[model samples]
Target: MPVESIHGRGATRNATPTRFNLQERMAEGDWLDQVEALDGVSSRRTSVTIEKPKSILTRNSSPDIGFDRSINAYRGCEHGCIYCFARPTHAYHDLSPGVDFESRLFVKPDAAKLLHSALSRPGYECAPIAMGTNTDPYQPIEETWQVTRSVIEVLLETRHPFTITTKSNRVLRELDLLVPAAKLGIASVAISVTSLDPKISRTMEPRAPSGRKRIEAIRLLNEAGVPCHVAIAPVVPQITDHELEHIVEAAVEAKAAGAFYLPVRLPHEVAPLFRAWLDEHFPDRAAKVMATIQSLRGGRDNDPNFFSRMRGQGPWADLLRTRFEKAVKRYGLRQTRFPLRRDLFTPPEGAQMRLF
Candidate 1:
């Protein structure tokens, strides 16, 4: 069965059965019948589920990543970026890393409360807590749930240092909190702009804000006294790679503090899903794109090593790095890491009382 692109969605299929044995019934007679019934229909309404976890902060020791602690307000991202490395996470819930990862969503409503409790612990250590490390913190459902906003409120009240990375312009919604946090040198933001072309953005990140909107967001954030940067994450070869210099120039024009990028990565189930997406959207050069990506990943679909995963190893990777370095230098955009202050961190009122 050929995978056909769904309208307003990035993944062409609902279940990818091979990787994790998730949704293995797709080949069943009854399942095929059901799938056939919904072949051309594209109206996939998003469904939200509330999840109450005991804790909200996640601690990781990944050597490549900058931060040690992070918060993910939502489990499945509605942005529906076909190449999202986080999509495989949905398989843990017996859901498909394909369409289900975007449509069937889970939100941690108690995130703020849990974060407060964690911060109030007797031995709690203050570090920059990262948001949007896995799934986007400002994904569409955030408008109603406001979980991410609530988490930010807790962080602000406690005077904890934090950072946010998102592809949505929706981060501006919490400017009231962000502006104050930024003034204290405790907060910063990074907006991802994968491609300047609207057509490519629509198909690649179907539900994410357009590249134009993201660029405008960087401008607005910087003007508001917030240290903002541009992330050209997962620069798809044979697709959006041509716009590298153009994106860097745009970031400079927006007064971005710095800019960075990563070559496309396809880890776990994302590889097949991305392949299907390629066949659906860019059938013309899909093969070339994969070849380039494999070259960057050392002939594998993905490079899972520590430092190498962040920066690919090969001529293609070297070329991307050289181009990015020259562009940032030529455009005068600083490549320096955004400095966040941790000295100002203060325990929440409850924690302070407990100390006394």
Candidate 2:
């Protein structure tokens, strides 16, 4: 777990799959496999595979989740956030959730088409569809793939309401669409600012937009009449917990509409990957951080309880909430939700078709 080895990656190595797959690679017997893998087989090269999903919008009924429908243009994220809760999902694809989750990506190139098809369905509802809830819709590959932009185009044409939560400043590229959508009360964006410290951000997210860039993006988006909020996510105890107030202050300074924070949750394979990251970077304070995290989670790595999951119940959680509540009040960020236009929704086939 050398610093030099993990320079470009978030997790130093890929973890074993949690679920058994037909083809599994065991490093125990094959020294040649290790040799081949180490010899530049994965020297920071990105691999993008096409995912032909039958549908784009995914519906979830988790009580704690804010939105019911969402679209993830990509299966894995290149930003390489070590503590990402979505990492374990890679197991279903017969892939490792650690490094492989970041390197090997699956892009749904036909997402926009599928979304239109879903919207065309007779029983389709007009509720807002969220994007970037699972994987970031705007990643490095997005510049080339442009899948997210296409999806937005479809939404715009259909007059659909949607929200985007992302950590990438690259979302600025779609300002033309977002600016108009915001005016129509159809769109809003939230950016995650984990730490104001550039050093911590680099190690934590690896390839995500810098803290400064995300703050600036918020400022620009808000200036352009778009509702922009800040999310202080996965506030790692003993590591990033100290930066809570500072991040909120910076977000306010950046003109963020409002702000919210979530305590770090290490679910499934994410625990080991995050532990690996801790051992490599914050070795000195790893135990204390985990101990604090456990204290917040009822002596476990995670608390999957519905309401408490988003807002941990404890003194530490209380402190985080206090700081956030005070910060939002001090900044005078627009607390009232900038509601999206669900009523303005029109079917993909237009008014004449809706008349039927």
Candidate 3:
């Protein structure tokens, strides 16, 4: 995602269409022509739409990510974290990845049905499924669609293993399923916390739950026997970077099983969006911040290389890594990952079961 605007949203900004739509996963951009406002001037409100996808399961063998298959219940995230690497994906829909990425959202209502169909295949292989890999599965719209919960119901019913990550405490709504799944060695959750500073969090993640709320969610999840960990993501250099140790400390206090951090990544549009954010919030240190980030990213806004993308390089990266390692050691937190059981998977198709 290339930078769209410093304005609020990761909001639906009207921008030129992107150059590629490889598999033709494209849609015409919509406009309301109704009244909305930005910069104290009028603008149009972004609209949400329902989309029916032909399939939901996405397979990625990238070494950087832990899972091979994943499902995203929603296309755009309302939690509008400006530095979201996934935001640029909205451009494929011929819309602005900026505002549209946040204001405009799309939900897959048939996610559960789709999953059932895929799992019913004769040679279907069972593996830990990752949810919210592209966008937060438990975003605000899930409040109404309940699509995420619907998908989880299918996973639980079929005895499938899955993991979900989110910054929203809304996850608790489905704890009934998560708790039992964990008991069966089939579920894990990671709550990403950027900063404990209320002011920084509110500005950077306008719609996400407060850091306090997310940490509490971890504490509660840990109590329920679910493996909950903390991800201090997009560690903004010179700004939120200082809170790296504090976030891990808080996660430990909340009984988080593990903690990790990823340096800010500005794949495409996110670079400019993040730059704008720094200029607005940390004007005095904006230049220094980007400089430090570039130094860590091989003198570029981002380093898309495989292993290094997750594990950064350079002096600043080394420092953050060292800090994270010491903090994890201090908290007695070994790798916080829990392997879900693939053997437990059961096909939902009655015909297959009847044949057995």
* CA lDDT of each prediction against the hidden true structure: 0.87, 0.83, 0.81
Error of 2 at 64 (Å): 1.2
Judge candidate 2 at residue 263 and give its lDDT.
94
Off by over 4 Å in 1: 1-5, 18-42, 351-356
Candidate 2 off by > 4 Å: 1-6, 21-23, 26-42, 334-338, 350-356
The regions of model 3 sitting more than 4 angstroms off are 1-46, 351-356
1 against 2, candidate with superior lDDT:
1
Candidate 2, residue 112: Cα displacement in angstroms equals 0.6
| RMSD in angstroms between candidate 2 and the native structure over all alpha carbons | 3.8
As a whole number from 0 to 100, the lDDT of residue 251 in candidate 2 is 81
**Which candidate gets the maximum TM-score versus the true structure?**
1
Q: List the candidates' TM-scores in order.
A: 0.92, 0.92, 0.90
Candidate 1's displacement at residue 160, Å, is 0.4
The positional error of residue 157 in candidate 1, measured at the CA in angstroms, is 0.7
Worst 10 residues of 2 by lDDT: 25-34
194, model 2: CA deviation in Å? 0.5
